[model samples]
Target: MPVNRTVNVSVVFNCVQNGANDFGGSATYTQSSSTPSDLGNVVDSNGNIDLRQASAYDPSQYNDSVDFVFTLAPQSTGYVTPVVWASRNGAGATIVVPQGGNAQEFQVEQSSATPQLLTIVDNDDDSNTYNYKPAVELPNFDHYYISLDPRIVNKPSSTNK
Candidate 1:
């Protein structure tokens, strides 16, 4: 039997005062188990977590989960709490964290093999309103793309006398 696996991702936000007042963010991932690794570091050369690589999994083999933890760096000025959303293939997005919510961490259960995309935005404007639409291009928001390739492994059947 395969054991369950968990992936931990750390998120950091930075506010840049580039005349236009821009925000920058980054994410990195680490797996819990190394014996049967199902995922790589997931961080691209640009120091961003891009899971669209070879993140393959087999539901029948093991259950996989991912946790995204957010952190506001000291340099992230004029920024309030963080809110998150998830969507697939340019469809409508679902709120993972509501505005002004006290939760700083969100959990994602990997049940489907299809690809997914998550967006994390800071409430820099301190507004209580939000639009849960995919690819809306909100300021101070970062995208974490996930692509899970399903792998089916066949097991040998047992023969009884």
Candidate 2:
């Protein structure tokens, strides 16, 4: 027998200008399959993506897993392209990681457009830094998810260095 498969993938950028402020513009792109077709029908002028999961997931129903979160910030204006890779214990959560809480959560941010690529590298590897490697693989009977957020960090209150 032979195996063939086609994966239809899409990404939605929840764009914002500065901390939590709306961009006051709209983005035209296809939303991820995790979202419904009719729901993500509009990317409002406020730069808000309408695609949202209607139901809540029960964490207790699955095994231990990591939730990768990527927040991208662009220097100026250009189409934003993002990528994601997953692995076990690949990265750290600088904001919220309780002493023994869910170490499964990890977060990273790309503050400038200069660094066009964001790669997750494990501590063990020392070569080929550009490689997009996942520290862990999908676990059996476990649930995992990725949260991609695009926002601008520059605000009027920012100071020049």
Candidate 3:
């Protein structure tokens, strides 16, 4: 099987933007920690976080790997998408190594209409440069059972982004 080498990241002017038939109103696409992306072992090591995994992962483990977090108020996506969630490392917690920490997380917005086409966006630009890329492949990415879904989001997921 081939491996994911590059993840294309982009920003969203608005989730419920006046595009895609005004698929805008206030919508967001996200996957729970159960999804491979959140716990998946597809770290980029040198580049930004794997775009594929980021798109797949929900806020479940989001706080676990990133330093700062910022999300613009829901845009005009016009669809009531589900809320994807995971066990984030929690706020004010110091990030450790080996197990990874929130300091490595990246911020990216995506489209539930096409989960597979999930895009990466950076609304916050403090000390944040890029989403945290895994230094190695997360075992969860390849193996199942390593992590399970927390059943947070109720919306239907799109294809793999």
Candidate 4:
């Protein structure tokens, strides 16, 4: 049997020049009592989070979910709004905005083994121009990107009772 894993990620954005140039952002996995071991080791040295079950298991049997919490520096708390861009292989993943929290909180559910890219862009002036936009509109700075690559371990046998 496969298992469902949950990973919590904390995103911090430092908006400089009102998110114009030289803006910086980072994301790190947050540990909690309910965090799964597989997802716990998700973060790599390069800061890329890959959703893969280390144990030998079939990918089809498991689903990985991520909870993202976004926070901006005090200077840009009300000035900049971060946007999430899930463009590469994004169709295989599902994004949900949780209620009760500010606009920065959201969840991502991924069931496919295909790799996907989620980019967080700092939206200054609180404009909607960057919302749900394509990758081509992504700015060069003041943003962070996370790579999701789910790996399949064992293949399920075709013949079954």
Better of 1 and 3 by TM-score: 1
Model 4: how far residue 75 lies from native, Å: 7.8
- For residues 55-81, write the lDDT of model 1, one tens digit per residue: 555646644433322221232344343
Q: Output the number of the lDDT-best candidate.
A: 1
TM-score, cand. 1 vs. native? 0.28
Given candidate 4, what's the lDDT at residue 154? 19
- CA lDDT scores, all candidates in order: 0.31, 0.24, 0.26, 0.30
**lDDT (Cα, 0-100) at 111 in candidate 4:** 29
Residue pairs in clash, model 1: none
Model 1, position 46: C-alpha lDDT score: 27
Stronger candidate by lDDT (1 vs 2): 1
lDDT of 2 by residue, 18-133 (tens): 33322322223332322222222322222222212112223244221211222223323432223222233233112222233422222243323423223221121111111121
Each candidate structure's TM-score, on Cα atoms with residue i matched to residue i, is: 0.28, 0.20, 0.20, 0.30
Count clashes in each candidate, considering only residues at least 3 apart in sequence or on different chains. 0, 4, 31, 0
**Which candidate wins on TM-score?**
4
Q: What local lDDT score does residue 98 receive in model 2, on the 0 to 100 scale?
A: 25
Model 2 C-alpha lDDT versus the unseen true structure: 0.24
Q: lDDT by residue for model 4 over 74-145, one digit each (tens)?
A: 223332544344343333233222222233422333322422333232211121111111221123333333
